[model samples]
Target: MTSGSDGRRPVLTGLGAVSCLGAGVGPYWNALLAGGAAPREVDLPHLNMRATRMYRVPGAAVPEHPRRHAGVPLGAVPRMAVAAALEALDDAGIAGPDRADVAVVMGSEMGNASVQEERRGAGGAGRPRWTPLAVAGAAVGTAIGSRRGNIGVGNACSAGGYALGIASDLIRSGEASVVLVGAADGVTRVGMGGFDRLGAADPQRCRPFARDRAGTMFGDGAAMVVLESTTHARRRGARAYAELAGVAWSCDARHPTAPDPDAAQLVRAMREALADAGLRPDQVGCVLPHATGTALNDAVESRALRQVFGPGTDRLPLFALKAMIGHTSAAAGIFACLTAALVVSRARIPANAPLEQDPDCAVWLPLEGPLRLERPAVLANTCAFGGNNSSFALTGPGGTT
Candidate 1:
């Protein structure tokens, strides 16, 4: 007999997503495995980002379905969040039309890129600021609410993954037995232009950790998970994707865009994560790298990764979501985390399209294949421009994994 969800450690029971690849975790996973689409050209209306080659979820549809109260607005960040959250709720069985014992933890990196644009426009005209949608639009917690879980975190690019980590904590604290954690971001002209100005965006595409990589291509999407303790889960006869084992975060406080090259803080965070999980660096089956494909980030992360995991850290399986879906800012962290989970569920990771092994990345790159997992445990890493670094660990339940 299986132990009740509450009796067992907290684990992710369900997942939902709306990414540049597509809506729904199933579609995105299929596309990712099929190598259906890589980033491409697009126009961001908010910043009037014209003639820009960016990553986008092709044929993305936010249908005005009756199920979601007329559905979310197509192509909008909030819309994506709402859609993804509802789907996550449904997947988690939290949608038994019950709103109790559930809370929402939502995080976004580009939160309401349009609001800033409007604010900038109004400021130029000396106009007073007041728009209900402006703040609400970007607020992930506001975008979607759950019966018991609602937490918002913005740790730069680590926003979403951090949200999941904190939600796991909330469960550990019994704040909410079930937490709906969400991460979302928008690809507005303002957002993309800001990165472009920072020289963090490629005019064409994203090639994470690639030696010839230029910069990340901006993409927009949402990713979320429903986490619950084992006792509650079994009481409700729920299934679980994996148990959330550990998470760690740190800040270099170095530069706004450039990371602490040595990544001392970053390495410590990863080590702490492994320690929290009671696992060794060598036990790490795979590492979901935060390779932005930029010279500095890749170099810094590579250095830190090698230092922590050492010689064979490169032997660890590596899969960069940005290479296929582009970077979703706040969404990147959790999306990558979900990718880790997906790898567990699928027991394989898709190839990195549009990305080739670089002389530098070769030391840390993993082989692409009919991905297989022996233990179903994974480590996901993220770093932000403001020196934010974090790592989280999770594993499949039942030892059946």
Candidate 2:
């Protein structure tokens, strides 16, 4: 999975995350390895719902950024994005003149929805706190001084992966040498109410692929990754955590909220993504699935996995992060991507949280403890509303098969 002669391949140089586990990437990774849970009662009194549990970042765990946005009143999502973006840039050692060519691409399902709700609650008497462009991408671009461009994607839960794919395209097309890409989402009254109305909110913790799994619990968090062209990375002497081997997306277009039970589109996305990487299913060390814990979602995803990996699917390790961090919506895809990056870097798969394996989910889930990877490549999957599905391949710095 080396870059072409022109160094167009995108390599992951740095990662930053503000998850329910904590603010820094170290804490998030540690919590995943420890199989910790951070569930708390949802406090939104405005939303009427039976499912009230959610995974929230502690108030103290929120990173402070005094210089971000200066006098502009920043929303929680943008603030989290700025914090994560700053950490990513610092982690990548990308500063001075290198910052000028960077592009900022972020995704969010509910961009400043909380701010909008607040303004609406106030009867719009005061100055509005949010704008159409008050998304994570704008805030990150402002904070990082990215002159190339700022783009925001609102592709539901799959937006994060879409952001990464878009950034890679930008680099490959020579539109930008570097791109800061990821996603962020904060809880909002509208978001919670909508899920509750749809009966998709889990009353307890998220337990993906578990027998009694009811639904997904919402989580607040953000994740950012620094992507640079191999040529630029080499010229700047930057160390890479992983390479973005390949990414592909597809839409089922069968239903607006529920995925097609047949999973035909998802299978195509996975196969096309593998083809793009020029790798076989057996070459992948593990899979990070978008297991939302819902009965239909888990089952559909399992069928898709079986279709793509065949009998080998039963033996391939499946790492379900939503069980640990809850589903972060727009941030979910990149969070999984970051976890994959860590998995390849460490060569170990974090254990899926405790759960009674669902007979319906035919994939192998490592619940006992960490499972060591035999190879450095990982396939990360993400699916969203509107029947959108995305799959991407990531390889460690050592390269892929």
TM-score top scorer? 2
- Give lDDT for model 1: 0.70
**Candidate 2's residue-wise lDDT over 1-401, tens digit each?**
43444488888899998888989999888889999666998665555677878899877777655323545556678888888888888899998767878898889978767766776656647766555634567778777777888888999999998988899899888888899999999888787778878888788889889999988888998999999888888888999988888899999998999999999999999998888777789999899999998889999999999999999997899998999889999999899888898998889998888889889899999887788898778999999999999999998763555
Ten-residue region with minimum lDDT total, candidate 1: 65-74
- Each prediction's TM-score against the native? 0.87, 0.95
Task: Give per-residue lDDT, candidate 2, residue 5.
Answer: 40
Evaluate all candidate structures by whole-model CA lDDT and list the values in order.
Answer: 0.70, 0.85
List where candidate 1 sits over 4 angstroms from the true fold. 1-8, 45-51, 63-75, 115-149, 362-367, 398-401
